[model samples]
Target: MTVIAFLGAIGPLVFIHELGHYFAGRLFGIKSDVFSIGFGREITGWTDRRGTRWKIAWLPLGGYVKFAGDMNAVGEPDAAWLALPAADRARTFQAKPLWQRAIVVAAGPVVNLALAVLILAGFAYGYGVDRTPAIVDSVIAGGPGAAAGLRQGDRILSIDGRSIDSFSELARFAQIRPAEQVAVTINRGGHRFVRPLTIGVERQRDRFGNEYRIGRIGIASGSPVLAPVGLLEAPIAGVRMTGGIIRGTFDTLGQVISGRRSIEELGGPIRIAKISGEQLSLGWAAFVWLVAMLSINLGFINLLPVPMLDGGHLFFYAIEAVRRRPLEPRVQEWAFRGGLAAVLALMLVVTFNDLGAVGLWQRLAGLIG
Candidate 1:
């Protein structure tokens, strides 16, 4: 059941991502040769009236759409496409105007992001957010909040001049700004005052032994309040949530790059599968949320300015726009090769981290001993 649930979660995302490219190509009058939901040997397939071969392949990890006039999934132009008649060449992806090609390439990531927003909006409208007011129920003795003269029943109005809508917001703000002194505004008995509190920092480890630092103010909040979202406001809330996730992802990546965060925090397919199975066990709502988060991750990752990614293609297009011509094929080929190598290296590292997190190596060593 777990395996099934994992597939159920990943398959649709891959399909939708490829579908975005396919639809965008068709919209620009470009022909598609294949729309595959996986790599390697085909498990099942059917050809459509548009001469597009839609197929399910053996590997279920990722998918691609092969456009006409392309040699492969990487969007390399084919020599045979150049040899084609003018009428047919006009229908090829590479033969399209630069703007059209750019749109077709960018459509995949855009659709993934849009899908996340739509899913989140639907969830918000159906089941309102579980929120807690930014009111302190208790402050730990001798902790940062207590030391700063905070007391029970104090309503937190803002932190560092940023207005706090809920306790979760306050906690998130603190978590990311560990060991920093922040100006917090609280309303006590109809009077508001600012308090300078240096947030305490704590290093926490998860079940996997992955450690990260978080800020602590030693404040507790009351029970959650169900804040109902109206249909009209749901989409706006969804966009806001998606933007927050994207910002958080970049911040974490920046931290990892800057040595503030451990590289072991990175995870690959194994971690995704484990998370999906756990979310499935939790309930439908949790699984849906996982899907939404994964969609955002996918979209953001593809937009990274690395070769062999949509962002890479966009980067090249920008150069073409400025220079008024595409880069030489050889240059593009070498760049893509380097990008592929980098991607493979990153994947291996993340996979190793995932295995370590699950204690696979430790279990293997135990068995051998």
Candidate 2:
């Protein structure tokens, strides 16, 4: 059941991502030769009326749409496409205007982002929002909050001039800025005052034994309040939530790059599968939320300005627009080769980390002994 749930979570996302490319190509009159829901040998497939071959392959990990003028899934132009008669060449992807080509290539990630927003909006409308006001119920004795003169029942107004709506917001803000002094505002008996306090740093470990550091101020709040969301307001809330996730991701990446966070926190496909299975056990809503989060991640990763990615294609297009010519085919090919190698190396490292996280390495060592 866990395996099935994992596949179920990933398969639809891959399909949706590929469909974006397929539909956008069709819209721009660019011909596609194949639309596949996986890599490797085909298991079952059929040719559509538009002469495109649609298939399901053995590997259910990812999918792609092969445009007619492309050498492979990476969108390299080929000899066959070049040799096509002038009449048919007009329908090939490479023959389209640069803007059209860019749009078609970019549609995949855009669709993923849109899907995430819609899914999150739907959930918001159905389940409402959970919130806890930024009120201090108690301050830990001898902790930073106590040292900073914080008292019970004081309502937190803002942190570092950023308005705080909930206790979680304050904690999240503090957790990312350990050991730094921040200006905080509080409301006490119809009066407001600002206090500069240093956040206490603490090391934490997850269930998988991945460790990281977070800032704490030794404050606690009451139970969260549930607020009902209206029909029109749901999507607005969804957009806010999605934006927060994206910001948090970039911040974590920045921290890892700056040596403040460990790279061991990064996880690959195995980690995704484990998370999918765990989310499934929680219930359908949780599983769907996981899908939405994954969709956002997929969209954001593809938008990175690295060769062999959608953003890379758009990056080249930008150069073409400015120079009035495309880069040499050989140059593009070499760039893509380097990009592919980098992507594969990162994948291997993350997979190794995932194995260690799951105790697979220890089990193997025990068996060898």
Candidate 3:
């Protein structure tokens, strides 16, 4: 089930991302080499009448669109188009205006944002988000909140003085908060009790690096109340949710860089898979939330300024815009190599952590002992 959901969620999402680049390239009159759905060797594919080789690669993890002149950028041959005259080179990606190139580069991540909005709007239209009260569930034993004396049936009023009139508000605060002391207000029975919580670092890992965080009480959100507004309002709410998530992601990154956090707190595909598995076991409502949350993550990560990513390409475009031409091919080549190395290192690290998250590490430790 997890496998199914993960593939269903990622495949269409990636197709949309690559389609953005492909369509934008066409709009700018840039020739595309291929429109691929996955990486590595082709599985099933057909070349378009325009000579673009559309194929699904063996690796199902990610996809990309190759542009003409991409081969030349790396000093490779145009063997596939050897029949074309040298005069036709203007159709290559390099021949496009700097602004057009920038637009093409920027479209990939923009499509991701659009997909997230659409998905969220779908959920909002069919099953609108309820303004659920921030009701407390059970606390994990020995966890930070338990250590702070939080109990069941407590209705949280605020966190660090941020008013939490709804579960969404509470979560809005929680999403960005790392390991830090926080003040809380909860209505216990009929009386409101204020308490302070000092969160200890909880570490996680991803395909990039370790990350750390902190949170107060464990929570099982009460159902959202019908906050019914209007039919046209769902899209607005979806876009707002995407923006809020992006802001929170940036805030978390800032916290991590400031040494208030650690890298071991990151969670990658393995963690997500587990969560997806568990969520499926529960019900569709949980699954929908997971999709929305993961959509936000996808949108944010693609926009990160790492080389080989959409944002990185956009960054290069910005440079070209100022300089009036692309950077030296050699410079772009070296940058891409370094970016690939970084991505690989992060992937290996996260994979190891993923195995450990499934108790592979601890079981090995016990065996050695």
Best by lDDT: 1
lDDT of 3 by residue, 159-178 (tens): 77767777776766664574
State every prediction's TM-score relative to the real structure. 0.88, 0.89, 0.76
Pitting candidate 1 against candidate 2, the one with the higher lDDT is 1
Candidate 2: list runs displaced more than 4 Å: 153-163, 174-215, 367-369
Of candidate 2, the 10-residue stretch with the lowest lDDT total is 205-214
Per-residue CA lDDT of model 1 for 226-302, tens digit only, reads 78999999998889878877977887788789886679879998889887887887789989999999999988998
Q: What would the TM-score be for candidate 3 when compared with the true structure?
A: 0.76
lDDT of 2 by residue, 1-369 (tens): 568887898888989998999999999998889999988999999998999999999988788899988999777767687789997899999899999999898999999988898999898898887688899999999888998889998999998888889887788888887887888899988899888888999999855455667899989998777789999999997888788778777877898889876778789888888888878877899899999999999888888878888888899899999999998889899989988998899889899988987789999999999
Instruction: Flag the better candidate by TM-score, 2 or 3.
Output: 2
Stretches of candidate 3 off by over 4 Å are 72-87, 129-167, 175-179, 182-214, 217-225
So what's the TM-score on candidate 2?
0.89
- What are the lDDT figures for the candidates, one per model? 0.89, 0.87, 0.74
Considering lDDT, where higher is better, how would the candidates rank from best to worst? 1, 2, 3
